[model samples]
Target: MSDQPPRDSHVYDGPVGGWGSAKGIAAVARTARPGPGAFDTLRRQNKPGGMMCSSCAWAKPPNPHIVEFCENGAKATLWDLTSARCGPDFFASHSVSELSGWSEYDLELAGRLTHPLRYDAETDRYVAVDWDTAFAAIGQELQALDPKMVAFYASGKAGLEASFLYALYARAYGHVNLPDSSNMCHETTSVALKTVIGTPVGTCVFEDFDHCDMILHVGQNPGTNSPRMLHPLQQAANRGCCIVAINPLREKGLLEFANPQSPWQMTLGAPTEIADRYLQVRAGGDIAALTGIAKQVLALDRTQGGVLDHAFLDAHAHGLQDWMDWVDACDWAELEQVSGLTRDAMEAIGAIYARAKAVIGVYGMGLTQHVHGSDAVGALVNLLLLRGNIGRKGAGISPVRGHSNVQGQRTVGITEKPELVPNDALRDLFGIAPPMDEGWNTTAFVQALLDGKAQGFVGLGGNLARAVPDTDRVAAAWGRMPLTVHVATRLNRTHLMPGRSSWILPCLVRAEVDMQDGVNQQVTVEDSFSHIHGSIGKRSPASPHLMSETAIVARLAAATLPASAKMPWDHWARDYARIRALIEVVYPDDFHDFEARMNQPGGFYRGNPARNRDWQTDSGKAQFTRPAALDATGLGVGPGLYRLITLRSNDQFNTTVYGLSDRLRGIEGDRMLIMMSPDDMAAEGLVAERRIALTGAADDGIGRRVAGLRVIPYDLPRGCIAGYFPELNPLSPLSRCDLASDTPATKGIPVRLDLT
Candidate 1:
């Protein structure tokens, strides 16, 4: 049966949750067929002190209810723990060239990888290899090459135990060339948060959601990407908390939702309306809108008595006047032109902010995946700072993280940069001098591989070849590496793009029990809100031969590094408690008594210094950042071109394609379609459902283009078009990036739709 969606281009008009979400969850289960005990996987998954959702990084509340998982969480678990198995026979049946033709959705659906497979270039097929032989070969390659010649690609899916080991192994091997998933998605959030707030993470915890009087959601569709968030939002709405949604599309999740988990709501069909005010901002116009709002608020403070928190501004913030001056200097016409909103509309938004005593600003990739993404994030923070919204209950900046453990992984050392974590502490802990040299991020790592400067590459979890921008270039670059190793559960496009010698090391998924030396091990993972919780998978492994990510890291370390002898690699690998013990020593104040807290009722919250009002910024106070003018970043759709932003289909997560349909937007049975404004479509004489090509207008050295995409009329800005990524990834300019964070400007692609 085809798991592809229906061929109707009808949008889902039902409430966000309720029966629609139930059907989605049930459909995912039937498609995944993750064995008979799949029900158990759903029950144990994200069950408070159980294994957290292996999906998005939206943190679980401190005291989670019995049924804590959402539809997305259920889908993720089902996908990971699917019953389908890909073993030696499956590899023998399909050649690398032939398998490359299969869709990403089909490849992952073929099931969990059951063995370590080495690519046989002669036959263009992968053959099984023993763990020892594969480990030794990889070790020999590492031993032969200089550490600088290698790049370590890490992501957030791995548990904290495994990620810590991966970082420890990389440092022990004498280099810090670790590029990770954060570089692609939330890196700008980190850079901006650190620069102004003195913390490189979201200041608000799940607790803040309970107390916030109002919520301003910008550039995020939580209905699809983070369905679990609907729980808190629905609760907040029920409690009379006002919400404003700012985005190009009118997302149904933000409009109304009926919690699937709530029996009364589900049965009665009584849905809670979410967004009190919906503001449709133009693509990449978030900063412009933010500036206008700030300007209006300043005006309101002048006219209305005591609107701005003067005491908070004077005592806890710096550069207030300069920021206010910049806001005042912004021209109303320019702001209106850029934001695509009238002055009155902007003031109304400002009025909401001015009225609220405590407000929370939540944003996602929509705010951070642009050329001026860092500036946009800083501007959002400035709005919060103006009213002392941050570092207090019910108010703060929350950049909704994408990956499950991306933030936590960074907390435990999955970074490409240097000196972020103190080197002396690492050296003293492991008796190994950590490499101090700045390393490559995702963008630099790709370039280095293309330049043939890197000899080997190791991916901890993510599908790097498909996930990165410039798909063709990345795939070609993958073939140039001398050795490439992937620690993964499912087969993907990246696994097929092998070098001279490539190893696909099969690893256990999050929903499977990881047995270490006869002990069922539970690993820790950090959530978006900086809460660290234990994750213990209860289901059996897809394959008996599968190795835990922790074991893989340990074996790789033991084979490659002599310092592995000094470190308790064997003990730590056998029992994850040892890993926690080591982590506690490294981050004493945060992870104190780490092992003891694993089984607690609710996971420990690693307090954010910024949230506690302790500003450790360079200025010793919260810095009021002045966002640049609308045209400051030099961003544009080009002459006769449109701004193309990549979006995630309701069925997909990152690069993983759950299905071929996006029910939210009504497109079905296809992923290769672009949503355009009707006016833009008419201007270009392009009819709806007509197939066309999109050419990149970026001046980057490399040529970028994608062909055979259907255009559909949608409610969006005139100069903006929307397409799905990994498909549209080729159109993303490799050179055009957020300058401050080195993140690819994925959400701001300059493109021209071609009909001829």
Candidate 2:
């Protein structure tokens, strides 16, 4: 063997959530040094009247563990509660041009923003400004521009109370361009679920895992994205529930798991195996694999009388015959080729599903961030419907949401679609004639900026500049905006890209106390399971100048809108309960008894009507959807061209990079490496650690390219490559997106790699 550095391709054989997880948490603690108080905050996470984890949106169990927090949750908490501070002095020391050169990790790791800041073009640096001055300037700018020229972008981190106020403020200003994080990640799920089951949210709860006999996990890496999910997968595995992992990579988390909280398992070095069979489906081939499995089930139903749920189908489902005919028309050879799997494997998975009485289908961005993501999600729902897996205990579709409260933001009227908003109710309650036209989603917002149509931007929270596709172009467009106001806790890439008149308003994080009108305040967040719970911070605010998200929105609304009886901005700012009361008034069905139930342990469940067999669709029944095509990517595959899939490291959450090391993937100190199959490397005459350049094959004439990405040969299918996101986000053009959901095809972009 050649004497060279190890090619960042070591396989991680250890079980998920063992000592490795413990080490990851410890590392974050060391880096953050959140002090002894952080331990108390960690202990209170996901508990009754406790703060929700700032990481993933996994539901908390009714009987919570003493250590309910996971490794990722601990990292996020520590990160939020870090002792480091980014005050006026820090900004005074560094210019925007200089700070723009820093890495994303360094920008966030520098510390929390302590004071509100306004960009001073004369000095090319940010200067401290009082809240009143900043708000007045922003309000004046908003007054000058048309409502349609401004876009209000909400991050998933904002709580329901804050999000409601933000949406209210946008509408009160006569604008509805409320683009949020959901527009990028789970918008496909929302669209597909609504079309099929008449609901936008998932139908399953945390307890469903306990009763599920089989779980079909597709396109999601629970280990890295949502580590808390491992507990349920472990329990289901221990009880002999057959789990079939359907994804391109054989993720270590789905293979086995050792609960770090369990002393017995950790001490014994024993881990419960997770997936009984791992199907390595090709990137963007989810529809084909789903169709292949459904075809096998249909064949089995034809030969065996008890295979299909005829009773459930006849009463609750529509368009079954058309869907079955479409599935029948799908050629097995074509499916095998597109899915990169054998027919026998699909048959095996179908057999397991046929034998199991209850099955749950779990998926993530891997299915949604595709060219045909809506179709792929519809296909998965169709597969689950064949066996009557929906609307029953232990069986339903679970889309693993990335950010906490992302779903809640949409539920509380933070959507761009006019139909989803309670326009009449808002008009009657708030005495404001909110815009009825559909506004900009994320993609449209970016396009508006690129086209110079957008004049102002108000971000509730998020690194919009780095998270979206066409990073360089988006940043350029963002910089050209007449005004930009960001409400955030820390310094992010989006904050650095100052517009002509930009402001960064410091806000309190989830782990910090929010005292309003001399009383402690609690905000509510809805989890992936549609359970709404209250989160009250235990620790003091990171900075004295930091304002609560609700307060920021309230004050901004007060500054922007004229004095009106219906819009009680000051009252809402004084007490968050007032905002929750309005939320209850707006969404009485979901938020009924909002205060009483929100104080209860684990809060209350926002019941899914579909769960009770009450289909809210146009036809009054769940509909079976036909896949547009077998290939979900809709990208051309050819020699020297590879389909790219973006991934998140174990050390990273959505856009927050905690560290450079990815313990689960055995990657360290680097984020620019590309993961490719050994066979593909050989075919391309590329060796491990060979630097290469990838150019996107988008037909929009935009040259999307990134260079100097070292290749690491790994266990993946041919004609496929993987890289960490935000780094590879440049290769994803804005034009290459799902038309139905407008979600960037980040998971399946066609690219050509050449040796650099």
Candidate 3:
């Protein structure tokens, strides 16, 4: 009878630390009598309120640290502490037209939606309404749109008092289409580093990686996406510096990273060897591998002529001879077939920038997911201004940004426009006159929701219909928005791309607790090394009917403004330190002492005067231009066309999904694949893992096909392919992007493929 007691002895009883030790010993050899919820699902896998330590949003904290998370912040803290809940009688039994036909992880695992919701579109569903009738039906649908038909997006995990009261309720609703998630990642390094070194971000810090000797990790990875930048690239690669990388996918956490917060290197399992020089390149061929490493650093300054700083290019700079005549008119075999890299790996990355005397580089969105992504970030700041590597200590140019207040939600004002001087000291500090002009970004709010001229769609925490690309043309231009709202903390696929009335609202959760009015607030983020800290939560609000994205942007700007609007939105929503004293009367030279430097504790210091060389540009120096050499066959190619690109995984970030798995190109559960280059998969006879499909040549050309995918074949190069972004954002076509930063070149999609 004891031998008969073997049905599934609590299947795979424990330990799964590194990629599930052979699937936890093959679930203990197919369960010997398992079922009792298999030891309560292996004692609830990531247990202790899963979502790994020091409050995640993919942790950083590090200053006098006590371990801050990472590993995609422990898979975004087990996908936001999922034990799920979408209460209020599951939206009174489903209806925003059948829960907008479910699936954004089944309306965020059906949980934590305790209250506020509205979309009763003829009772087609979504009702729980109560935060004052869902902030007066989003202030009666922003008082029936036409404030330039409304758009207000802003999601870099909304903080700093809900993006300064959602840019003071969109300049009290005049307009400024305020699209967010920095127009889908590093708005081409914030429009080419604020038009060449006036600064949009990254003048480097964290003790400038201890005075970098060489870094260059172009087209970034930071081990499974910013694993606390693997303990400063393992303390500058155990003090030997020179990293390099330039990815196309060799990324195994940049080839070996162990530092789980290094305690003498995590008890000697000590990994971090991070790329001393990898360089696979290819996808959108990072501007012909950054102009073939600036033509081998201008042929090593013509055979090492004092390694050229030429006195910081004759004091600061400007168009160095039309960037040396577009790198001596390109064509080194089409820069080795668009950067599969090789003139001895472009002279060993120009001999580590001519024996580095403090280098840095960095970069992400694989060089700004691009169609000349701002001329490949101005040719990596024209190879860091051909050696002056911007203003000093540990060279410059970083770009790795991915949320954590996406560059502090474009520094306090979730832009789209409204900074062309709305100032009258921010209209006597928010009394009125904020709307200045321009707006609608994210390619003009997806072309004003595809030219219906945007109706309404607020967001304030992204997933903008799966971080946009083409995705059924941005979910059919967000279903012709007649109101879409969202605010969120959970539930995504851009909250079911609905509209014609839809809400969701929930909020809170940057590792929880927010409170507001009665106090316990905190917020404020901005990191990809621009610093500005103070995050303050410590778990709690997965419920209690979550809210605090600064109390839903001050009760949706006091239920959509009009007591003839003029700020004082309930005294700056009951004080976020008077919304940093009106963001110090609108960015007083980088937020003067915004509430005494956010009451100290890693939060103040906007100072980035082009990291010292000053140049707030329009010339006080650091201005450099000349970029044309463009022509990637100006989108007209054949011989089985090509290009593609997309990317982002190591369990994704922009467009959430913490794990559908991608453990560095060994992919796993599946993100469809594609990759390419074994000579373009044996010149399309195709092989490695096969499958394929692609298509899209533009406009009803097989209406942007896609099909199976798979194909794999590693080290990409021959005319490119890649994949990943919102699953190959249907091979990217919204009339491509980056004609000087309109952005959407989600890393170059032109396509053709086949062999499915």
Candidate 4:
């Protein structure tokens, strides 16, 4: 038995909503001066068949209310339409060296990018350059380099239209090096879900929350990462749904949520109590916990005939008896040892699952950002498959995504590994030969850059330098590149870490009203549940010079490719509907009747055959897998060593830091802090507020270490510690990654911590 950590000084004890959410929305709304009211902007966001909120991928309402966005959604919306402006004059005064020293928070606060800038070697400054000249310069470098040397990356910031064009452009250049942020976040979900369900996306829709009797949330803090999700979670709880939370930290939002949207919650009624049973498990131990639950469920099914849907299993699934036998053979002692969860607790949750007619298992990267990330996903699916939860009214497995359109980008061809090469239809449509060879993913691209095999790079969105593991290492490789281009809405750390020749091309954000050729245009984005809808900006552009992502890709494509390699690049850029029409041709089954659906109430679903129990897998039925997590133990991590997992603050979204204060966790004025269990802290001779250093446990030839991290003791699993990412990303070596997805196993970092 180990002693729990002391109460954190900064741990927020306040209820989720009440005045907190109201103040947050008001504060964010005020930042966007010279813009419309926050309520007005929110109204436009929910307008019938209008632009989707840029903040998160949570499902929006079909027939929405006047204020359709959550507090975080409001923050993301207003931040993009901020009154503060950053133009060429500001850059003229600030040298690249000076800007390099600024923090990510301060850099974004400097405001939206105003002009296209190119690095001037003589002055070490980014001076504004005309779009054509910048395009031509980059084109010449790409022409000089081998096709394999060019690495084109996309991000959630780029909508479906831009993503499709970027993927098309890269392949037209004779390669498929189109690695995006999906490779870093939910790539494991994409791979694992497809393996079992024959589709890469979730089988359930937002409506599932309403009908579900129980929700088994594992390894996710929806309060911070996906705050919007808290709305439905609270609503579900209010409706008497039993919610069970399995996480390292008992987050405030999961404990007590105050929905500002609900009048009863805002005024006098008690705040919606979220978790009926909150189980704290060791980080990366979710798979073991899940396995234990499945063991209990299997036992209940064998003795209690109706517990498992035997009919559904016999009709639609295979390999169940083998999986059940494997579960029965598991040792309870090892399950508790690995998961840090008691057998009694596991059985209690299993009993809940057995009794409930409908159950939904919702999870996040806490399970997928580990060494056995893919296996963890499969394990969750296995739990769902046991009771025939898929294709049901209120039952499914959801790997909740963080970004706005990371999934949508993948749907629209922002992938290096394309299953379909240019068939006769593709070749005839584009008049270009699609590359046959598979391309590099994020991990492959990183290794390629370090090995000096990759030369040219084009980033559609995202801060690649800071976002990737080993920030300094990635930045070094990026600087050595012959040419690099960033098409973005605002300034970021990656923009400052430039190549020998780099261009910063400003683009319109989701908040900005985009009018091409005097005609108003709208772009489409797919939510986490695979619902595609139109997004049209209500506010004016942050800068008049800023172009749309579609326009930027179109120009870049026109400049790089020879005229013989033909496509309707210019025409599609002028009218995005043309691009949608092309999407219809490319993916007819999904994007068919794209325009009419975009105009309809809410949006139409991108049909998933697996949702109807139509297994597209090679086996003819859903396959259950036994995860490798059973072997996961901090084996050699004894005295001074620990397994560290990186986290994001409630104040930030992905790599975009809105503020330094993490209001949800009650931390302020710093980001270099680590949360540890009391027993682990005492063992390391660490005291409260003491600064510490973290060194990579494994000697992978990359001596990764980070200093100046402050200690904060909290109730956490023993031998496990947590720290904020992008800051702690340096300590997490690139070698620590899942072999299945190449996603850096940031959550499964083995490290040795000591006083700084």
Measured by lDDT, the strongest candidate is 2
> What TM-score would candidate 2 get against the native?
0.98
Clashing pairs in 4: 51-535, 51-536
lDDT of 4 by residue, 1-756 (tens): 023225653477667766787777676556545375435667777456456788778887686766677767777877887878888988889988899999888898878889999999889888998888988888888888898888899877678888888888888888889888888978888888888889888888888888999998988888777777887898799899999998887677778888777788788877878999988888778888999998899889779778888889999887887887788888999889878899999998999988888889898888878778888888888998888898888998887887788888888787787683334556788887777677988888888888888788899988887888887788777788888899987888888878888899999887677898888788888888888878887677877888999999998888888875358688889999888988888888888889889756557898888888899888978988876656332233367668887888877788887777677777777889898887777877778889878888866777888999889877778888888988988777776676578787888688887664
Give each model's whole-structure lDDT.
0.85, 0.89, 0.66, 0.81
TM-score, prediction 4: 0.97
lDDT string for model 3 (1-756, tens) is 001112211112211123332232233223223233323322222122221122222324335344444445444544554555777777677655566565443555554555667666576666776688778877887797787777878767666667867876787678777777767767878778878887777787667777888888877766556666666777788899978787665656666665544455445454555677787776666677777877887888888687878888898888788778867877778876666677778777887787788887888877776666777777778888888987788788777776666677677777775554345766675567666678788777787677778888887766776667677767767867888888776655666556877787776565565666566766566566665565555556667877777877778877787664456667766657777767766778877776656534444567788888887767667766655544322454468777776767555666665445554555555677777667666666766676767877765444777798777665555676777777678567666777766777766677777664
Lowest-scoring 10 consecutive residues by lDDT in candidate 4?
1-10
User: Model 3 — TM-score against the truth?
Assistant: 0.35
True lDDT of residue 38, candidate 2: 93
The residue pairs found clashing in candidate 2 are none
| Candidate 1 TM-score, true structure as reference | 0.97
Error of 1 at 64 (Å): 2.6
Worst 10 residues of 1 by lDDT: 1-10
Please name the candidate that would achieve the greatest TM-score relative to the true structure.
2
Q: Please provide TM-scores, in order, for all candidate models, with all chains considered together.
A: 0.97, 0.98, 0.35, 0.97
Question: Which residue window of length 10 is worst by lDDT in model 3?
Answer: 1-10
